[model samples]
Every structure is written in C-alpha cells, then in structure tokens.
Target chain A: MAKVLMKGNEAFGAAAIKAGCKYFFGYPITPQNEIPEYMSRELPKIGGCFLQAESEIAAINMVYGASGAGVRVMTSSSSPGIALKQEGISYIASCELPCVIINVSRGGPGLGGIQPSQSDYFQNTRGGGNGDYRTPVYAPANLQEVIDMTMDAFDVADQYRIPVIISADGMIGQMMEPIEFKERTGRSLPSKEWAATGTNEEREPNSINSLYIVHEDLEKHNWKLDAKHKLIEENEVQYEMYQMKDAEFVVVAYGTTSRIVKSAIMDMKKEGLNVGLIRPKTLWPYPYKAFDEIPKSTKGILTVEMSTGQMIDDVKIGNNGRFPIHFLGSPGGSVPSPEMIAEKIKNILGGEKK
Target chain B: MKTIFEKTKGLTAKPFHYCPGCTHGIIHRITMEAIEELGMLGKAVGVAPVGCAVFAYEYFNCDSYEAAHGRAPAVATGVKRVHPDSLVFTYQGDGDLAAIGTGEIVQAAHRGEKITTIFVNNAIYGMTGGQMAPTTLIGQKATTAPYGRDEAHAGKPILVSEMMATIPGSAYIERVAVNTPANIRKAKKAIKKAFEIQRDGKGFSMIEVLSTCPTNWGLTPEDSLKWLEENLMPYYKLGVYKTPEGGANNG
Candidate 1:
C-alpha cells in the first residue's frame, strides 16, 4: 500500500468510514471542525449519513440513538464540547451501547483556549459522566497511529458493548502525516441481538435502556458491567516498551508527549544514561504491567504529559512505589520542548536517591 | 359476535407505572393505537422521554429507545436517518420537550427531519416530584414554585405547537387535548396524521397533546379534566397551527 499524506482530522474521519461506520453526528468545535467538515463531504459520497447537530449534547444523543438501533455510529468534539456531552455519554454507557467518540481535545477547565492539551486525561479515564462506568480510551501519538486507533476503536467498542474514546489533543488532530491505509481483520464482532430494531411478531420488542430503578436489579446490572470491564482490563492492555532490557530509569508518557519524550530519551542515551520509554496506547486499562518489566537497577521513573501531571498518578500506581517517581508537565496549551524534557530527565538521574 | 373493541396490539402487556389517574396511560394507548391503525407497528421505532413516561419503552410494543432528558428528538433524528423507511417518533413531556430539550426539538423541526413527535404538555414536571415546567401556566402551583408561578418572575407558558408552526420545515403542527372522549378521538386522529406524514417522508410533524398530571395537580382525574378544559385549553388554544397543502404529502 502506498502511503498517502493526510491531516489528522481527515484521516480520523476516513478511518471511521473504513471501520464500517455509516452514521456520524457532530457539532463543530475548534481543532476538530475538520472532522465534521470532512465527514459532511465524504460520508455522502459513500452513502452514509452525516448530520451537523444543533449542539454537542444533541450530537451524542444522536449517537446513542443510532447505536441503540444497532448501527456503527460516531461523534467527535473538543474539550468544552465533550463536557456538554457528558450527560448523553452517561446514558450511552449505561445502556451498554456500542459507539465511538473522538475527543480532539483542546485546553480547558472552561473554554480555556483552543490549543493542544492532554488535560482531558482524567476526564477520559475517570469516566467524565455521572456513573460508575468506564469508556475504553485510546490515546494515539501521531497521525498514523490516529488512523489505526480510530479504525480499531469501532471493533473494540462492539466487542465490549461499551463506548470507546479516541483521546487525541489538538496537535495530533491538526498535524499532517503520511500513512498507508490497511483494512483491519480477524476480530469477530458479536451479533447485535440486543439492538432495538423495530420488532415483528416473530421476535419480542427490543428496548435499549439504562434505567434500572429496582435496587436489586440495578445491583445486578452493575455487577454484569463490572465483569465485562474486568475482562477488558485483563485482555486489552496495550503499551510499547522501548529499550527496557537493561534500563536504570523508565520514562512513561503517551500521546504526542511520548513522541517528544522519545526524542529526549535518544539525547540522554548518547550521554550514556540508561533510560527507556514506556508509552501507553490504552489509557483506561492503564498498562500497569509495563512498569513491572523495569530492571531492579532502575532507580526512578518519570511521567511526561501535556497536562499538569494527570497521568503521573497512574504511573506511580503502576510502579507501586518500587521506584521513585517524578513528573514533567506543560499545562494549558504549552508543549514541553525535547531539550526541556531532557534536562528534567537528567535532573531526576542526578537527584538524591529516594 | 364480532369484536367491536380490543386492546391495541401496538401496546405491550407490560402495565404502565404511572400514578393512578395520570393521563400518560391514555396518551400511550392513543399513540400506539395510531401506530396500529397506520399498520406501522412492525416498522415504528419510538424514542421514550425522561419524565413520567420514561418507561414508555416497556409499554410500546414496537422497538424503543429511552433517551436522556430532552434529547428524544435528536435520538429520533438518528434512528430516522439510519433507517429511513422506519417510522420514528418521540414521545416527550413538557419538561423533556418544552424546557430542557427545547433546542433539540426546535432544531429537529427546523431541519425538517422526517419524523413524528408526540409532545405532551402537562404544564408541570411529574417525574421529579412536580417541579415547575416551561409550560407551567401563570399561577400554577408546583413544588419548585411554592408560591404559585408568578407572572412577573416566570413569564408566560410556552406554546410549542404555535412556535413550531412558524418553522418552514414543520409540515403539520396541531394542539389537541385528551380531557374528554371527543377530544381524545381528536388527539388520536392528530397523532395518526402526524405518523402518516412521516410515512410519506413529508418533513417534520408534531402533535402537541394537552395532558394532565393528576397527582401533581392536586386534583382527581375528573377534576383534572375540568381544569385542563378551563385553565389549559384557553391558554394553549387547541387547533391546527399549520397544515401543508393537500395534506403533509405536498412537502
């Protein structure tokens, strides 16, 4: 396959179409506007439906509806827009509907700025909505990874009967890269026997709902969901270990931050520092096992993120205090340069032993 | 002997969870009856609102989805867009349609979504213990409005059908009440007509049915009917606000 140069947002849209999704409902927000714009132009050509929703709230509900009807559907939005979508996302998760949600996140506590930020790490991994549910979140580092993850997200969503979120920041959403398109294979999706397609006399009416009002019944539903999540955590943890064979220090990072961290690690290696990288591909099922592979000689671990140390907590938890942990972050739309990250890593290596 | 009446097959055997004397039962029956009469029972997909009728999915025999509060219209749009041949309808109450979901409903109609909407206005939020709804009339008492709805503070009740009528995409808009047997017949007729318009792919159609929340209203079912006739009908003004030429098919 020949590599085609494409912008991240356009590649995400194209990947979704290739994943067999036919329904897209989204509202325009900064950095991710190109996604809806691309869908509006391309989806119609493929006989798919693309609707520009009135609001982010409306877009997610539309996804809830289409997913309940047993169709592969998706919606994309940014940080503030994702906040508005929390209510509907909760409904979709509770209903156990299969859908893909893309968060090309921008800086925000509340409309902070329309620049790249990994601030939504907590929001995506902690289940931004009002429930005891989890959305399997994938954070891709580059345009090529974005295409692969966006395409795979639909299958993962269907397999678990849960929502899958592609959490990419504005830099990943706006950047262009060359990528080869490849069809995903070998994942058998379960039959949508529970979908609420209109019923005939031959079959009972199907109701797609999340309302379990009875105390005992609600408890049973929660337990069932917990069991599925346990399976996901066990079977679907993904991470990339770079040069961990004889490392004394491990640098943990993900998304675009991981790319810069990789560059910094290269610079450190040239200076005879024994450092490796553990880049998490899955954020929710947090790849805790990656930390277990660290050699006993490893004295410290550092987590680099675009947010103010959100993923550092996970890194600490993953290592389980076996090693001293440190953090390097640039919050609210600032990207830490490779030199700055290299300096931070050198300081950690030189700092007094914990 | 020939059967003159039987329960509509459009409804399921699942009994409703509504309060005694609540008009939701009647509304549910009539809407399903419309689906049955149109021979759309197998193809009808209903979106249930987040109010007293939140369990509407259990009652409707057709495929159903329970939407988040005020988002039924957007959900219906999704279903209809995916399955264009299917009959999609949203069953929403005042709080779900007139208040919280106002933007979704208005924009759905503005886009001329080919779906039917059954907007039930009972003037109060029944599910959350009778809070003031957007359709709560002046002087209407609600849990949130302990001193009665003040005209100065709450302004006037919203007239959804009249407002929806102004949108170019809305092909048919009607306001009917279900207080009396005669009015019940009219209400069912309007619901059926709205579905028919949707079947013909004639743009958006909505039937705003004036309903009553008896327990919330502090009235018996009988008195609630009288109250609806005396208080709500005058304010809501029951009639067709818009009807496309040669019926909804013209669109």
Candidate 2:
C-alpha cells in the first residue's frame, strides 16, 4: 500500500474498507459526507452494502442491525445528526455489540455552525447516549492519524464488545495529508456462527439483545456494563506529553486544537517561557495518570479549545484541581490561531521567573 | 402430546417476561406457530422493538435482535439485505411502529424490502405507562388522555395498516384482532398469509393486530377482550386491507 494524499474523511473511509468493514450506512452531513460518498462508490465493488439512509436516525439504526449480525459496520455524522442517533447508540451499547461511529464534529447548541469545534468532547467521551455507558473515543490530530485511528477503532470495538468512535472536528475531516493504507491480510474475521445468515447446521439459534425486563435483573445487567467500562479505564488510556521536564506551566488540548497548542508552545519557548503541552489521544480513559505526573515545577495549566471550556473541565479533573486552570476559547466556529493561544498562555504565566 | 410451548416453535427456552394477559404473548405464539408450520424456524430472524415487547429477542428461539423504539423496520431491512436468503421480520407495537418509527416503516416498505412485519396496535403506550400513542383510538381514555381522546385537541388516531397500504412496494397489508375465538382464527390466517408473501419473495408484508391492553385500559383481561370485540373491532374492521390480487397499491 503506497502512500497517497487523501482528505481525512476519505482516508478514514478507505481504512475501514481495508480493515474488513463490509457495510457502511450513513446520511449526508457536512464535514463527513465524503465518507458516505466514498463508500457508496467503493463498497459495491467488493460486494458490500452501502446505504444512503433516509436520515441519521435510520442510518445509525441500520448500523445497529448490521453490527448485531456480528459483522464490521459503521456510520458517520456531524453533531446535530449524532444527537438523533443517541437512542440507537444506547441500545447498541446495552447489547455490547462492536461497531464504529465517526463524529466529524462542528459547532453546536442547535445547528450552531459547520466550522471546526470540539464542543462534542463531553458527548463523545462520555458515550453521548443515555444510561450508564462509556464508548471509548479516539481523538486524531491529523489526516494520517484519522486513517490509523479509524482502523484501530474497529479492532478495539471488536475486542471490548462496545462501540468505538474516531472523533475529529470539522477541520480534521477537511484537511488533506499523506496516508499509507495497511496491507490486507489472511486474517479474515472469524466466521460468525450467530450471524443471521440462514441459520445453517453449524449452530443453534442465537440472540443479540439489550433488554432485561425484570427490574432487579436490569440492575445486574448495568453492573456488568460498569465492570466493562472499568476494565477499559484501566487498560485503554493513550496520550502524548511534550517538554514537561522542569516546566512551570502546562498546556492541555486535543484533536486539531492540540496541533495549534504545540505550535503555540514552540512560540512561547522562543519567548523564554518554560511551558509544556499534553495531548490526549484517547479521550475516554483520558490521560489523567500521565497528566498528573508533570513535574512539581508546574504551577498553572492553560487549556485552549475550539469550544468554550468543555475539555477544560477534563483538564481540571486530571489535575485534581491542584494547579490553577485557565481557559481561552472561541466558540461557534471561531477558532483561535497559534498567536492568539500563545498570547493567552503568556498572560496566564505573566512575569513569573522561568 | 405437545405442550403449548411445543405447539409454537422457533421460540427460545427463556421464560416470557411480559405481564400476564398482555396480548404480546398471544401474538408471539401465533407468529411462532406460523413459522413452525411453514418450516421456516431455521431460516427466520426476528427484530423486536423497545417497549413492553423489548425483550422479545429472548422468546423468539431463532437469531433475533432488540431494536430501539420504532426502528425495527430499518433494522430488519438491514438484516434482510445482508442475508438475502434469510427470512427477516420485525415484531413491533403501535408506539414503536406508528409513532416514533413511522418514517422507517414507511420507507422500508416503500423501497420494496423483502421482509415481513407484525405490527401490534393496542391503542396506547403499553410500556411507558399508558400514554397516548399515535394509534390511540378516538375517544379512548389513557393516562395522558385522562379526559378521553379529544380529536380537536389531540388529532385523530393514525390507521397505520391503511396508511402503509398506499405504498407501491408493499405486497400485503391487513388488520385483524384477537378478541373472540372467530377473530383469533382470522388473525392466525392473516399472519400466516403475510409471512407467505415474504416466503414467495413478494416484497414487504405487514399484519396489524388490533390488540387489547388490559392494564392500561384499567379493565380486566376479560373486559378488555370484550371492549376490543364490541367497540374497537367495529372501527378497525378485521379483514385484508390490501393484497397483490384483490386490493390496491399493486406496483
């Protein structure tokens, strides 16, 4: 697989096809519509299903059905459309099925704007649906990472028996970069005996369900889900922490915003400010343990985001509120440039001896 | 020599969780019996809905799924398209099939999906404590409609079977009730014929069973059955509403 220049959404779609996802169900939503359009052309060539569902509600439900049959399935949408899928997502989680959902997030409160925004940070990391459920989310910083993260999303969902989301903002979805697709393998997915494929002589009837009617029994079901989430938190936290050695200030950001924060850190360093940055790769089991280990010299942490103060809450939680937290953000499609973020960091660390 | 459970096939060993006298149990038996007689027990996969019948996956012995409220038709369409050889069906209630999932049901039939649906219309939201469903009868009293259903204020109940019969892709559409012995026999026949349409690859099929909700109606099981026979039956007439040979919506 030679390296090729592709937009993030197209790269993500191509990676899923390489990873053995045979079905793609999606509705047209800005920032991610390219994914469905790509699948509509590509999947049929391989004898796979590609449906431009009537709406996001229908699209997600179709994915739910396909995943229930123990196949690799996926759907992509933006913020408002993702909200419509919450009900189906809850049921899919309750049943512990494996699938991928991509949210190329845009600004929101109600059809806020289509420009880049991380306002869905809370929604994506916390499962975005009702009930006590947690779907692990991969926060990709660039187009290449978007492709790699989407492929990893399928593997992790299959391993954990839960949905996995590759959460990118509108900018990440639109940005173009060089991506290398992985080689297809002899490792085909294990035959799904429980799949609803004519119920051949291989196995007896099987059921994939999310309902436990007895009230007491339902509680036990939730407890089992709780146990799975705890296991994920214990094993699946990923991050990249930079220049924490003898630093006085820390900067925390993720996804596309994290890239801007890194550039801001370099500019701040040129100005003789001893600042470091922490970028979370997996937003669910957020890198709390690693973020807490930043040197004792760290006095304050400034968080920069495309949304006003959403991921700042997580940064504070990771720090145990030990360090003072400062937030600088531009909401409703106004993204802060590197200079602006650097200026905010300089203000937060005013006149302190480096 | 066989028990009631054996007489009905394609059902799992898990005990039913539905409340006693809940018409879902009766409907489940009739569908399972039809599958057994048709010898499609091995090839059948049912999609259940959220609500009182949410746990339907446990009762249907074949491979099954429990979909979110009102999206069973979309899910069944997915299952059928993926495994075109399998017989797919969605067992849904009025609240799920008519109210929340109206678009999915209409679109799946409109696309000529080769699947079957067993739509149970009991006139109220049985799972969510007797709220007014989209199919709640005119003048019917429910928890939300405590003052009886007011047509001017609440709008008229939707006749789903009649509505879907307008779609060109729908091969069969029928409405029947199970209040008396005669009506139960008619319902069984209607259900069997609906399944037969899918068996013959005739495209989408549906049978809307006008059912009784004893708990929500605040009546005994016996009284609810009588109410269904006397009042509900007259308005929701029991007969084939549409079919390929004898009715409308033929493509």
Candidate 3:
C-alpha cells in the first residue's frame, strides 16, 4: 500500500509477517525488544502465534520446533542474547531446518553496551555455535533494506533449508524511517516436503535429527552440508560498488558502517579526494569479486566499523594482500563520525601506497 | 491366529539402541503403544532429548525432532503451538530434564503448554557413563560422586513430578516405575492418560517413569529392577500428584 514511518525493530516483525510467517518466539533484549513486542501485539490480529520464551536458548529452540513443523518462523535478540542462541542455532543448522534470526547489533565480549555496534561479524559468518557450518547473513544499512531483506530471508531459508540471519546495528534498530511494505514476488521456493509435520500414514514419518553416531555417516552429512555452502558461496554473493570509476582508494564496510562510509566518501569527494565504498550485502558469501573491481590506481582499502574491526578480516581475505589495508574503529558502541572517517582516508593518502 | 502381542504401528522398524536390561526400551515401547491406542500415531510429533534416547526420533513412527540438550520442552511448546491439534510430546531423561533443562520444562508447565513429557529418571547419566545427575540420590555412588552423593555438597535429588504439580498450569503430573509387569502396566496407563490430557487441551501433562540403567548402575538387569523398586520407588514415590479438574487415570 502506502509507505509508513516505522521503527527498525517493528519493521522486522512487519516484514516477517508480510513474508507469511505464522509464528514468532523470542525473549526481550535491548534494541530489539520492539520486534517481539510488535509481534505479540500484531500477530494475533493476523491469526499468527507469538510466544515469549524463558530465555534466548528456549526461544531459538522454539524457532526450531516451528520450522520443523513446516511454518515460517523467526526470533530476534541482541548481542549477548544472540550468544545464548548460538547452541540452538547450531542445532537448527545441523537439522537443516528453515527459520529466520534477527540480531540487532550491540557491543559485546560479555554483557557489553546497549548502543549501536557491529561486533558479531565473525560470530555470524563463521558459524557462531560450533561444527563446520556457515549461516547466510544479510547486513542491511537502512530501514528499507531491513524490510526487504527480512521478507526475502524466509524464502531464502526455505529454498536452502537453512537458518538466515539479519544483522543490523542498534542505530538501525532504534532509528525511524519511512518504509513501504512492498509485496515483491517471482521467488521459486521449494515445498517443505521433508518437514516434520504429521505423516498421516501416507508416507514415512519425517525425522529432523542432527546426531549421526556412525563415523562415516557423520562425515557424509558434513559433506552434504559442505556442498550446500559451496553453492551458496558461488550463487548468493551480493555487494555494491559505490562511486569508484577511477577512485584513489576503496573503503570496505557494511550495515551502519557503510552508511557512514557513504557520507565520508561524499565529504572526501568535495575535497578532490575520490574515495569509494564497497558495501557487502551478504556476509557469509562475501563478495570477494568486489575486491577485484577496485581501481588499479587505488592505494589500498580502508575498513571502518563500530567495533575494533571484526569485518576487516574478511576484507583482508577478499583483498588477498593485493593492497594495503587501514582500519578506523570505535568499540563499545561508539560510532566513528563521517569526519573521522574522512580524516583517516586523508591520512592514508598522505602516506605512500603500501 | 489372534495377535496377542503384536508391535504397535506407532513405532518404526528401527531397533532400540538402549543397553541390555536398560528400561528405556520398555518405556519407549509402552509410550508408543499408548500413542497407538489413543489413535494419535498419525498426528503426533515427538521431541527426543539428547540423552540415551537421542535416537528416539528414528524409532517414533510420527513426525519427530531431536532437540538440543535439555530443550525438548521448549521445542515441544513450539511444535504444539504450530499444530494445535496435533499430539505433541517430549521423551527426556533425568540429565536432560531435571538438570540443564529445568528452566525450559518448568516454564512449559508454568505456561500450561498442552503437551506430554515422558521423563525417564534413572538417577544417573547413562550416555556419559554414569555420572551423577540431579536426580541421583544422596549417598548414591557415581562416576562424579565417587564416595556417594554428599548431601552437604551436592544436595538431595529433585522431585520433578511434585515440583511440576505445584505449578498451577499443569493439568496432570504422576510418578511411576516399570520394575515389574504390574508396574509396567500402571506406567503405561499413566503415559496414556498424559497423552489423553494433552489431546483434550488440558494444559501440561507429565509422567516421571522411574527407570533403570543397568550398565550405569553396575548391576544386572534383574538387580537393577530390584534397585529401582527398593531405592527409587520409595524416594520418588508412585502416585498422581495432580490432575485436571475432575480428571483421573480413568482406564
């Protein structure tokens, strides 16, 4: 219909429901509490189910149960809460269940701060729980992107039989922006024929399990999951290259950091410095190809983040020593200003190409 | 030829992985038989816990999920909410139910979730080779409790059924033992009643079936049965702690 002004957390719930999600289970955490609150209020109006679990562990397991029951389900949490959910997320991943997890970014190592931060890049992309697994992570910078990615996340989850994560910093979670609940179509999702719904005696009972006691059998299962990861890496890499026809250097960032990088690039351009930004949309299937597109005249890539530098490691992998890397970060929920980022770029320009 | 003791269709053809004389197999069989007798085999979704019964999903002839350690009750809540009309249950052990998963199970009961839980309390951790469990009796020797459980240090075993019954939302809570054929019959009756209560949407239902882990207990199958009757039955007791309004073991 028409665009409406909405908070980032509420838009998360609205997007899930718009994706035809019928169940939501979560525990309240700072910066993301509005998501579960929104679902608790709005879901019943649509004949959907919303439950507040005892803890994040229980909430993710509840998501597992609903996913196994062949329904569109989701849960949301902040940093520490997401850490508690890692075990259940791993179990859901191993069982090959489909569900959505929202991580409204906050600072962490323990119970850090409640402000905006992007410190969970490694935990989300490198399999937060355990084992050889990688979850598909989508980093959205703005509220509109949050709505679009949250809705598409479910379909992607079902198509691949994997849990998908939407990582947004506290800024996006708490910010208000005009968003249109667009009803996009043309997605081909596989039917959940393997779901653990009742058998009705028409076929073999479906069992969603992750324990493979046999040595060879466990290896086989790992290989099967590995094949899926490989396919995702090849087909699902999404990134954006902004204003880099013949730029001097590239700045790699995502989510809230990318937004700040855009401002820095604009500010730098006014001063005759052409700094470009490579924004990654999907974190796991990281767009290594984007690094290839960096200009030959570029000195290096500058990575900016809210944390000490979690995503910079990935930038290093994508760059593969092709250029020097610089980092400017403010941990514990502090965001580096656009001016600070521009100054860092100028400092890099002041030095010779490494 | 009349079928005197044919296997129930509620169970799959998979063989049991339980140790010889371990009562988990008996409990599994009777639980499935109860589901079959209730005509819910086609509409049941069971959550298997991560103890000795981790493979229970494979044996259940219905839609099933193997939940993470101690999270079966929460998982069952999810499944029951998704399919309100379907029969939902969790098969759990002492380590899986009483210890790590206490919060989930207690909250499930507190919320009056319409689901059944078959909690097997053997007082020891079998899969991990007989470590002390929260249900391990005081003065009971275990791998972790070499000199027997010290009440001064480890505390007494938790009475899960009694604790669950105290919750206002629980509709049915009972404790039973399967040490003898007569007790086996009674345990089956309690399990079936629990499922019936769940089918009627009568809130939370649970049956703590005092079981035997022969290998873990360092005893023969027969002696393990004796140990359950003499030690477990007396401490855990055998009776219904609560029931729905005007509800009973009607069968």
TM-score, chain B only, every model? 0.96, 0.94, 0.97
The sequence of per-residue lDDT tens digits that candidate 3 reaches over residues A61-95 is: 99999999999999999989999999999999999
TM per candidate? 0.97, 0.92, 0.98
DockQ of each: 0.79, 0.61, 0.87
Return the lDDT, model 1, position B251: 11
At residue A235, give the lDDT of candidate 1.
88
- Please say which candidate is ahead in lDDT: 1 or 3: 3
lDDT at position A25, candidate 3:
97
Candidate with top DockQ is: 3
Give candidate 2's chain B TM-score: 0.94
Residue A326 displacement (Å), model 3: 0.5
lDDT of each: 0.90, 0.84, 0.91
- Angstrom error at residue B80, model 2: 2.0
* Candidate 1 regions with alpha-carbon error over 4 angstroms: A352-354, B246-251
What lDDT does candidate 3 reach at residue B61? Answer: 89
The positional error of residue A19 in candidate 3, measured at the CA in angstroms, is 0.6
Place model 3 in a CAPRI quality band.
high
